[model samples]
Target: MTIRLASIEDHAALAGIFLSVRRSTFVWEDPASFQLDDFASATEGELIHVAETAENGIVGFISLWEPEQFVHHLFIANGHRGKGIGRALLDDLARRQPGPFRLKCVAGNSVALSFYKRSGWAQIGEGETDGRPYLLMELSKTDESTLSSPST
Candidate 1:
């Protein structure tokens, strides 16, 4: 397996994997929250990284925010969970994003919470917004080990 930069051609394949895993991984979220529709050519301060097999088939991805390097979204194929693909993606992003990175996890997403915790991301604070619970978490730019595994 390999992790590398993503391109427009990778969007469709990545989106397909996302859809297959969304129902279970993101059950706390709306099924359509961030479907990969307009991102086929997504650009400008956006970085989408993909984890693929040796033959170049997409399995998972993580989006790193430009300037801040905060991880925006990460997902792995439902069938590929527990295989460390998520960690590979996170490690790649951490190596590239050079700042105190941050991400939000819903209050009820125990799986995600555990993932973040095990990966070395610590909870800083939390509250609800738009009826959804949110916890503010950050990963120091130098601590690339924190995302070893997204708990769930």
Candidate 2:
């Protein structure tokens, strides 16, 4: 499997992967709100990326806004779940040595909630969109700097 940064030229393929995942995972959350045109908004130098397989390709993807490091989205093709792909993506991102990381999960999405929890993210807050509540989870890289209490 290969995971790499996505370029603007990858718009079509990336959009298709996202649309497919949306149908299954985001049926209620986003519906058709996320579109192909949105790929152009990715802009290079960001953390957006796609994951491909050795043979059956474009299996999954993930992205987050820079600095804020708020996870925008992550999805694996329907048939590709249960493998370590999702975990690999998370592990790879965590290994990148960022200051802090965050992602929001729909309150009803038990699968996603559990996945994030097992990966060491703790609930910090929540958000609501269109009357649906989303639980925000965060992972702060454990380092000497973070272990120390903030000074007043």
Runs of candidate 2 with Cα error greater than 4 angstroms are: 29-35, 38-46, 142-152
- Candidate 2, 30: how far from true, in Å? 8.0
Off by over 4 Å in 1: 29-45, 141-152
lDDT of 1 by residue, 49-152 (tens): 88888654787888877766667778887777787887677776766666677888887888778888777688888988888988988777456444454322
TM-score of each: 0.80, 0.79
| Model 2: per-residue Cα lDDT at residue 130 | 75
- Candidate 1 has its poorest 10 consecutive residues by lDDT at 143-152
In the range 83-134, model 2's lDDT, one tens digit per residue, is 7777667666665547488888999999999988876789999999778999
